[model samples]
Target: MATIGTHSGAFQADEALGVWLLRQLPQYESAPLIRSRDMEKLKPLTIVIDVAGTYDHDLLRYDHHQRGFFETFDGENKAAKDGGRPDVTGPETATGEFKTKLSASGLVYKHYGREVLIRLHPSLSANPDALDWVYRKMYEDFMEAIDGNDNGIELAEAVRYKESSTLPHRVHRLNARWNAPKDGPTEDERFETASALCGAEFGEMLRYIVECELPAREIVETALRARTAVHASGRARSKRYELERRHGLPAEGLVQFVLYPDSSGMWRVQAVTVEGTAFTNRLGLLEPWRGLRDAELVARSGIDGCKFVHATGFIGGNATYDGALAMALKTIEGGSTSVELK
Candidate 1:
């Protein structure tokens, strides 16, 4: 959670202004810029500039290697063909361009052996002011995370074994060491601390991977539809199998949510299914989500598809088209004791 700007070398608030000004250079202002096929050959220099501050300088000063961002591509820079020389090479510096076809393109930064790609929203169109806003905003959020970060317990520890040190055991031991109530009251307090810690940790990790890492803006709509289908299936065995067949869902995983009482008695909301592809297909089978009274279910599944689609990064409205026959699951449970007594 340590912020990029907190480090001694973090760009000053006004540092980005110089880079911003350089970005404003007209395509026709200079000779055509150079191009490099070897992405590793190009080095990225990051300047954290606060445009509102007292900073003013050329956004890009000449590197001895003769490199700058391409404003217009006539491909006329002298170093483009000569395999541009290294501008600054040593233990502290390495070279690369921070370019990604999916998003913004810029210089790649290597600091303390870690490589981070600097990018922006494409709609921002590489505008200096927009970049300024993004840098400051990111810095602010980073600072906030450092301030209010939560450390939670996980549920997976319940089953995880230990070889002197396993996941749940390790987690449980850590909890007892750090969070056991000093009052030393009842045995229940010990259980509560252990349980809560594990559950919270697992939930936090789950939420991070599911919510933030997944859910790309592009496929949000498609995922919503897929999720609706899964929600409509209920617990019907055939529906579950059919969904699996159609969506290539996994056989195992769980979804958890609190139950709420309604006009129909207590109802369980579809929080988020832990199963990946299997969950999608399960939902996929429940299509035409009309008359679904549970808005939470509807909303959850509607949003579920977006999560799946984003995670997989696959395109095609044909999520439903990829169907196959479901194999029946055989079970051997008999009638209840009440039935036998009757």
Candidate 2:
């Protein structure tokens, strides 16, 4: 049976998650684990992660502790060994080279994520675009934080506040408290628990993405394709959008607002945020029109049937489809009176 190796002492989320990610592959699914720092013992294992001070993909040894280990998921694919040669993908991180360096979990994820995702949801195999999107999405939505935190990279140049609600905190707490009797479960045993924790969380995220987010993507895509038919911007429409609390598609920089019907049967003219950002918008609705409702909003924006615009301007609602679209188009065209519903 193949054997996996890692340091035997304390464990971090990177190695815990790395161990779990490797097992997602068929070859390593049931492979035995050896937790030790002894090179003599590690030499014969099928893989070693987060230890041994080496980061060679060909050898199946992934460690980020070595000197000169500068790797990142910079969204540019490059050759691993040479680092300078650009390629579609190296055996290493799927992203050519990114601004953020990856940890053991990230390294494993970058290489084998697409495969794991396919296994988790077979339907993704048929849609290459979605597979690619999800691979990056998983990193942005989940793995990047693990990679950054494991690498000791600060969220900001200066820490503004203590953040303990993140996944890393959970993983860190799983470690047998420092003063506990050694008679408790061994480090190797606790490692299994940690890996399972990371795996379960990751699996839940993958589940939500495939089950909930992807279906919504279809609606957004259909709405996007027919945007020019509705308005030149295609961003402000009445049938498909509610991305304010969710993610919008990676539409480059074209979309500005997305008007979709809300659950209340009202049409929403939601502002499209800058891709990859939380709330910064590409363009927001007119300022004077915000915080107004009903007659005031209709009178202020000069668009009939306007209901209300959120004070933040991230979203607004209209009683009718035409009203919402008109609000969307007016924002895109800079409040020009000539811009009217076609």
Question: What would the per-residue lDDT of candidate 2 be over residues 1-342, giving only the tens digit for each residue?
Answer: 988888888788888988998899888999999999999999999999898988888999989776546567654234444555433233254445356778888888978889899988999999998898788778878998998898877877776479997878888888899797979987778889999999998999998888888787787766666667887645554232333223443443266777778898999887755545566766677888868999998889999888898776778899888888888878877841211111
Give the TM-scores of the predictions, in the order they appear.
0.18, 0.82
What's the true lDDT of residue 77 in model 2?
33
Indicate the worst ten consecutive residues by lDDT in candidate 1. Answer: 323-332
Pick out the ten consecutive residues of candidate 2 with the lowest summed lDDT. 333-342
Mark the regions of model 1 whose C-alpha exceeds 4 Å error after superposition: 1-141, 147-217, 233-342
**lDDT against the true structure, each candidate:** 0.25, 0.77
Per-residue accuracy of model 1 over 1-342 as CA lDDT, tens digit each: 111110111221121212222232332123222222222322232222221121112532222112322211111223333456433222122222211110001111111001110221333334554334333333222211211111121323474453434333443453234465677634334433443443344334434433453233224324433543433422212222223444554443211111122353322222223332323322222222222323432363442212111222111111121110110000001110111100
> Model 1 reaches what TM-score against the true structure?
0.18
Name the lDDT value of residue 278 in candidate 2: 61
